[model samples]
Target: MTPHNELRLLPWSGPDGKPCYLSTDTTGGPLSRLADHAESAQLAASTELLEHAREVLVDETSDPEELRLLATDLTCALRDALRVAASRGHRLPETHASGHGGDAGPSLPAAAFG
Candidate 1:
């Protein structure tokens, strides 16, 4: 049986909107390599966009339109980072507040992807 960590699939897509998944156990497998590269790229973008956000936020002369665009970029960066996180591990179980059952089963390891 596949490990639960490997089974933790993150539903995301490629630049062209093609569906993709990430699994750490693949090791040298094609999908594993692809996901690693994609995650790195996403991290890079997020880092740069974060710097841009700081600049935009502090610049008193920044235009409202430019600020809006920067906000959109930041949101995209955040989404990518979140996808990477989800791909590498399991998600939180549904809580009673969400109308789901409270029995959340076993807890996954902190470094489940590793």
Candidate 2:
């Protein structure tokens, strides 16, 4: 089993809105693959939303209602992007700071920004 610090942070939350984690020795498991696909889709959606936001920002005729809707979408996209980043960051392998074997330092929590 993977250590507590090494558990994978799933891309989606639970029914109660709490963060979810996966503990497995291999990354090729079904759950891991599902999380991978979900993360990829989320990142793509965020990228597309960014382009739309840029277009709206450049359009001087955009109304207050449109801007408000855009803000809501951007907020959702930002949340997903942050979750993906946190998940990937946690999975990153620890590295030595110098030639000598030593702890690189404490890692950021998987849900630090959640």
Candidate 3:
């Protein structure tokens, strides 16, 4: 059986917005392939949305309604991105050559995003 943390965090939710997991060892299965495709689409959409957001921010004539809608879209994209990050993070190997333990790298300070 797969370890709890090793279970794949599926791209979509289950009942009532709860997260779903897959325990199969095989990565090429149908569900896995679907999740992979969904993740790819989500990331691509986020990239496009970011570009549009930059344009909206730069345009002085953007109305309040437009800004509000952009904010909503950005929030959804950010949520998806965070979910993808968490899923990928859980799947990382226990050790790496970086010697910073199993972590990817040093995390940025919270103020960096401010």
Candidate 4:
């Protein structure tokens, strides 16, 4: 059994935003190391995506197709980022116990912009 302190939880989020920890007790555990490396890559991709968005915004002749592509990429990147945050035990800035917004599958909550 690995000692509790031998494990380090990365910023990576798990199921339902739970923190994912890497057990370092076994000096040569490949899975943990791989997970950490993948997480780092995800973070780097996010940074790159943000910078690209800035460039596109300032460019006057941005292509519509490129914009759509960017939107798709941004959505995936943002979701991953949010999952990492959630895994670190962070709430998603708002409590949406109710539905997301008006006519959003279920009727909107009483407080609109919450």
The number of the candidate with the highest TM-score is: 2
Instruction: Give per-residue CA lDDT, model 1, range 2-99, as digits (tens).
Output: 33344544435769886465545545667666666778888997898898788889999999999889988888888888877876555343344333
TM-score of each: 0.62, 0.80, 0.78, 0.53
Task: Give the winner by TM-score: 2 or 4.
Answer: 2
Residue 77 of model 4: what lDDT?
94
Question: Model 3 shows how many backbone clashes?
Answer: 0
Instruction: Give lDDT for model 1.
Output: 0.70
Tens digits of per-residue lDDT, candidate 4, 8-94, equal 556566788776666554534687566657667888999999999999988989999989999999998987777565544431233
Which segments of model 3 are wrong by more than 4 Å? Answer: 1-5, 96-114
- The per-prediction tally of clashing pairs is 0, 0, 0, 1
Tens digit per residue, CA lDDT, model 2, 65-101: 9999999999989998999999999888767777577
Question: Ten residues in a row with the worst lDDT in model 4?
Answer: 87-96
Alpha-carbon local distance difference test for all models: 0.70, 0.90, 0.87, 0.69
Per-residue lDDT of 103 in model 3: 68
Instruction: Please report, as a residue range, the 10-residue window in candidate 3 with the lowest summed lDDT.
Output: 93-102
> Residue 2, candidate 1: how far off, in angstroms?
7.9
- Stretches off by above 4 angstroms in model 2 are 1-5, 100-114
Worst 10 residues of 2 by lDDT: 1-10
> Which candidate tops lDDT?
2
Error of 4 at 69 (Å): 0.5
